[model samples]
Target chain A: MSGHNVVAEAFAQTQYQVGGHGKRIVQVLKDVLNEVEGTVEGDMYGSGKLIADFEAKMAEYLGKESAVFFPSGTMAQQIALRIWCDELGLKKVAYHPLSHLEIHEEAGLRELHGIESVLLGEKDRLIQLEEILNLQEEIACLLLELPQREIGGQLPSFEDLQKISAHCREKGIRLHLDGARLFEILPYYQKTAQEVCALFDSVYVSFYKGIGGIAGAILAGSAEFTKQSKVWKRRHGGDLISLYPYILTADAYFDQRIPKMGQYYEQAQELAGLYNQCPRVTTWPEVPVSNMFHVHVELPKAELEPILAAVYAETGVGLTPYVREYDESTSSFEVGIGDRYAQVPKDALHTAFRLLHEKLQNL
Target chain B: MSGHNVVAEAFAQTQYQVGGHGKRIVQVLKDVLNEVEGTVEGDMYGSGKLIADFEAKMAEYLGKESAVFFPSGTMAQQIALRIWCDELGLKKVAYHPLSHLEIHEEAGLRELHGIESVLLGEKDRLIQLEEILNLQEEIACLLLELPQREIGGQLPSFEDLQKISAHCREKGIRLHLDGARLFEILPYYQKTAQEVCALFDSVYVSFYKGIGGIAGAILAGSAEFTKQSKVWKRRHGGDLISLYPYILTADAYFDQRIPKMGQYYEQAQELAGLYNQCPRVTTWPEVPVSNMFHVHVELPKAELEPILAAVYAETGVGLTPYVREYDESTSSFEVGIGDRYAQVPKDALHTAFRLLHEKLQNL
Candidate 1:
């Protein structure tokens, strides 16, 4: 009950997922491969026209002078920070404490690249402008993760972001955006991907997250920056003999999902309202700025799991199998609305939520 | 005539290749995916049954206690070296001057890992035992590449290799094998893959090279070493969400081609003999020790290219599209014999060689 097997079993028994299911993912990859004609070149190394074309398309979409594809977002972000720090001859970078680089990447920036991080801002909140102003040490770069994922997709206002960007410019510190969910947040800002990206010196986007590619990320910036990144990419062993599968999937997903961000965001808001109505349930943000928000319930994961399982058995609709424990009696889970959620009629979604609330009350 | 375009054009028109064609590679990937039933789980990170199974198979084949998959040989080897150097607290690694880390990786070992290299031997030759004895500094690891790829697939005698291995053991230095072409060289050593690997503390092999996988490398060693490598691999951004494609292709190729390496080596010897009989041509070692050898033609690449093109046009037999320039007049190209080469009739191959010699003599 406490290992990966439990999670795997829960996921297997679930009838629905916010993201596309395994069969759909495989079909997408197969379809993309079929659509692209001619022999897939580049052997085992990630080169050839396919990779070049995908990078070019991403650069054009992000309104950057150039772009490079990386096998993972962790690598893309680390390399971007490394390039900025090395160029300025400084090793100190500033970012929110909840940043992926700070918390998830095992401090590779410090251990591998010899770059120190100056953590700013409070936990579970958007980094305020004063956090930047309060920094006394000379930092080479500042990384901003839009709609901070670890904190329930919270985002700063457009005005606050612009002020932060202006402050970094005044201080001559490079700004890098960990825009892993940039597309998901764009609708709230009423901005184009390029408009949001232009505020930073470099931007990284994950194709596999909201865009639903199997795996890949694109780092876009000025031509010089991207050119240097390629060398670092090679050094980091990020350069594969071929990235055709990831590239084709990313391309297909961009076309299918990016334009519909607004609808997904609206669905998230509607979903949040349903959770809010249940006296035992509350949302972290009370509303969603993007297509994702965290839902907190009074019951712990152990008690909540079986109730959800019972609900699924009775209604044929699957809620989350487990919740992330927040306290002795409270737990939370992220609700990520995508094309799959959008396909379900609103009334069915309402019935599912009601059944979950009723089951929780009985438990 | 001198750039990649010419090479691409020639390859496009040629009916034969040292490796399987693009369609065949794609089909193999598809076939493997189809054969594996059920959802290939692991989410967007490589931590599932497929990756574990592949690693286990590789470990068993290499006679190692454990093995791990890396996205690139460059990353796998660098991580292996880093672990060894850190354990010994010595930053210096010994390798041949023409080693891939020394010449091809843009000094990433020094720049990224802070590991210095003690160049061990002359170019196009194996590292001698005397070279190891002469080193003054405390060395962390000694890297040996089987069939020394950069020098047209050259290998030392078994006795010499044993001497070097014993010396490293005596010095208490870690021995690492850059066994990228391990399978191809096995026939010459008359050793099982595990037998050759047993001499080294750690060994790396490329799936894309002899095994004909799309892209991946395997690093094998003791379970403790491999466990440490997983952390390093994650830090290097090598843990993909799914490595199903690479694993499946590797599994398929290992079964199909590994048993046929002896035949490939014999064919390489036959091909080298034919080239040696031509007055304008010479094989680098006069004979191949593996399934590949360097072909040095007396004409410059520019002079030889058009003649090869003419032969391809008239005889439907494809000579190499271009040769790597060795000097002002002489040029060299690697002739790698694989299953694809095994498909070509001996008479057709001889015809291609005869026509190439006649055209080159005229030029």
Candidate 2:
């Protein structure tokens, strides 16, 4: 096995690990599946009580007049931008350069919708209100990922967000919130989902990220925007014969975990502090604004692999499963706090962090 | 309740109703879920053993080198056409006017990919070889829906299909088969799935249709075509965090129901004959080309609704749950034979048909 695989495998076997709600496995859906009555009718062609109720609940939670469930956030976000573009009679939208649409979707927005994107900000930071106020392109929508997940979950101040939202509104450009990790930021924002979502014209939140559902998304907005989204949903084939499998789990997990955001945020801050204590290791933002952050170590990824593996073997605590080469000499990895952190034995976590710190000092 | 709702409710309660494999409900996935080990890892980001194995299995079954699992046939079929268009460096394709892409997808093909389509055949019949021979426009792909579904599961002779395939190949136009109900037609064609699939450059099969899966589709074709589809799949957001829910049910039901296509075909022939005996009722094509056929009645839909409801009430057997208006004085309904037909008592079925015939005679 390569160094990456060796570290990942060793992390998998560690007695305790920190990150994610749980392993992404079939067992994650067991809680909801076991309660499903086989005889009860599932939604057919996107209409049924199960899906309708969940959509309604999410819409109400997000303080939107309407909402539609989608098979993936990827589809929901694209359609959201598409709807705005169509409504405004323009085929352009703008977002951060590091946005998921630019980085991950393989040019779906460009190839599928014939919509052009003006990547607005530098790759390393969140979009600023100054950038929104001076967009050179006549764009239909301005998409903002709350907590800017790509940059170590760094979030802008709420006041700056309001200013950005107002400027977009005044400019007749739709403001869309890519709130895939919206739930994780609620504790830090000190806002209800509705309060935070109210700042944007539309919101797309995910069920699989922080909420830990199997997989699903909700696009919420005005009734008109949602009505338009349905057409695009069917166009994108998001209208499956049924989505009850995703709905039931999303509903169950949303109720069980929405209240745990505060605890997860606390865990993230505590964890980041521990990593920052190490000599050569530091966290972006020096503290976490939500339930996730990034750890940067001033060591080559190749050299850091053995240290992480050995730490897992000796301390029975795994920090991260893999290291990403940040540059020639720097290594990095992302961390998301979830149910895994609370389960770790307190002393073992401290011992592991102490060893990690000592190792970083020597390096 | 409306007449449609009353008739639908009555038919749903009948113990001897035929058409479809059980109800399109949660129970259809039970057999699979009961056998799944919760701890077994599910596919993540469209990779993992489960999805890979299922795609490989489908590819082998379809006599193709590769296959991809999509959340819906809509996404898969569009992607297939798009890939072919891109491969040939043309942005145009052709299909029957009644093809799902034309009639049902809200113009996804045109709007999403900016690909124009030429409707080659009349709406009322299958695309003929003559149309393939006489191409009025240059096209990248020609999509053929085997056993044309909207016009009531009518199919041209297999010889004509081979001829059309040859014409398309000679013209350097890729042929794609929208075989959503591919398995059902196998018995009628007296051909293996591979044998039929060999006629097309790409094939899209729906597990949710005749296979009675929850909701999933396979796009099978050459290694090169299938490789390109993955990029488009991600763009369409069909690449969910995991598709194991759809995969598990599709895999299980495909195994359980594939061999029963012959039995279902036989039942369809028998049922169509009974419907043909009624005074104002007739089966399209006079006989089923597969396990499905459309029933046309000389009476208006409003008038036929009560008559069908009465037959269901009197004989405890339901002919159809809904009637679609075919014209000013004609009404129609569709039927597909499955396990439900086998469960219905023979005596009750005969009695129901007798009542139906008598009611139609009076009308």
Candidate 3:
């Protein structure tokens, strides 16, 4: 197997996964399956009370008028943009260069929907209000990802977000929130999910990322938008004969995890502080805006991989295995503090870091 | 509630369902879940041994070099055409006007992929080879749906299919089989799945339609085609965190139902004979090409609905609840013989049709 697979296998065998692990995930699914009543079976193509209930609940939580469950955030967001552009008769959208739609989706928004994305904002930073004002082209929508993932879970100030939202409204440009991690960032913004979601005309949230569901997403907006999205969902082949597993798990996890965001945020802060204390380690942004941040270890990935593996082998504490090499001498990796992180005592995390530091020092 | 919803509710309460019922579906899922072992947890987004094993098995069964599981057939078939068109630098494909891509998918093949579909055949009939030959535009692919659904599960003869396939091959056109009910049609062809599938460049098969899985599809083709499809799958948001439920169910059902397709086909033939015996009813084609055929009742849908409901209320045999209005005085509905149909005896079906004929005569 490849090195990544080897590390993944090692991580899987470990007792505690920094994020959700396999056994725990299966148990959660089983528990949710058992608890799901009345609508044990969903519609043939995602059009029944089970999915409707989940969508309604999500919309209510996010303070949107309606919501539609999607099998993936990628499809949800792509269709959202497509609908916006089609309605406005404009083919252009603007977003951060590192947006999931721009980078991770293989340019589907362009290749599939003929959506031309105008990249705004500097690398590793939130899009500034000035950047939106500088755009010359007629654009249908602006996609904003809360706690921008590629840049170590960073977020702009609430005031900055308001300014951008206001500008988009004034220009009659629809704003779409790629809020895959919206739930996780709310504590940092000290805003209700509604307050954050209110700024966007449409919002897409992932059930698996912060909510700990097996897999699913909810795109929330006006009932009209959701109706159109349902048609798009079917076109995209996302309308499964049944979505009970995803719905039940998302429902259970939403209730379980939404309230725990503050704890995860706190844990992230503690982890960041510990990493900052180390001489050779530094966190991008120095403090995380959400429950995730990137840690840059001055050691190269070639050296860092063995150290991480050794740490897991010797201490049975599995830290992140994959590290993106910045250059020949340095590497960085994202650390996401989830429920699994809470299971490990803070001191053990400290000890793991200390061992990692010592191993780097020896190298 | 709408009239359709009311009818659906009544159908749900009945003991005998024309298709797989909710209770039985849940039981099958539970049984499959219990049978799954080793890698109970799949890859983060459909990249583990469990999914791989299922894909390999499907590919081998279909006589393709490779296969990839998708969350839905809409996405699978769309991606297949997209890849074919992109590789050939052609933007057009042809299919029967009533193909699922034309009617059901909200024009995603065009709206999303910029693929212009040339509707090749008349409604409710197989796409004739002559029609393909007369097409003026240079087309990249030809999508053939086995047992045309909207027209009554009709299929061209095996000789006709081979002729079409040979013509396409000579013209450098890619043939894609939208074989959603491929297993069902195999008995009529008197050919193996491999023999039928070999004619197509790529084939998309639904696990749920005839195989009785909850929901999923496998796109089988050459290894290179599947490799590109994986990228498209990710772009389309088909790469779920885990597909264990779908994989397990599809695997189990493929084994359970594939061998029994011949039996279902025979039963459908027997059922069609009984329907033809009814004075006020006629089976489309007079004989089914597969395990499904259309039953056209001389009575209007409005007049027939109550009679069917009354019959179900009096006897436990539940006939179809909804019927397509063929005209002001005629209506038709499809009869799909599945595992559920196997549960009902031939005499009961005959009695139900006889009663329907009596009721229509009285009206």
Model 3 stretches with alpha carbons more than 4 Å out: A1-16, A20-28, A37-39, B1-13, B18-28, B133-137, B345-347
Candidate 3 residue-wise lDDT, A97-130, digit = tens: 9999877888878877888999998886778778
TM-score (C-alpha) between model 1 and the true structure = 0.94
lDDT tens string, model 1, B230-336?
Answer: 88888888887766667767888888889888988888888889889876899977889888888888887777776667777666665554567888998788777
lDDT tens digits, residues A38-155, model 1? 4455434545676788889999989999999998998999999999999999999999988998877777788789999998988867788887888899999999999898878999
Q: Candidate 1 vs candidate 2: which has greater TM-score?
A: 2
As for candidate 3, its clashing pairs are A112-B112
In order of appearance, the predictions have TM-scores of 0.94, 0.98, 0.94
B107, model 2: CA deviation in Å?
0.4
lDDT per residue as tens, model 2, B267-341: 999999999998988887689988899999998878888888888888888878888889999999889888888
Q: Please provide, for model 2 over A1-363, each residue's C-alpha lDDT reduced to its tens digit, 9 standing for 90 to 100.
A: 353476898898899988988888887776677778878789877688888888899999999999999999999999999889988999999999989999999999998888899999898887777888877889999999987887899999999988988888888999999999999999998999998999899999999888999899999999999988999999998899899889888998998899999999999999999899888888976789999999999998888988999899999999898888889999889999989999998899999989987887776
lDDT at position A170, candidate 2: 87
* Error in Å for residue B105 of model 2: 0.2
**Which of 1 and 2 is the better model by lDDT?**
2
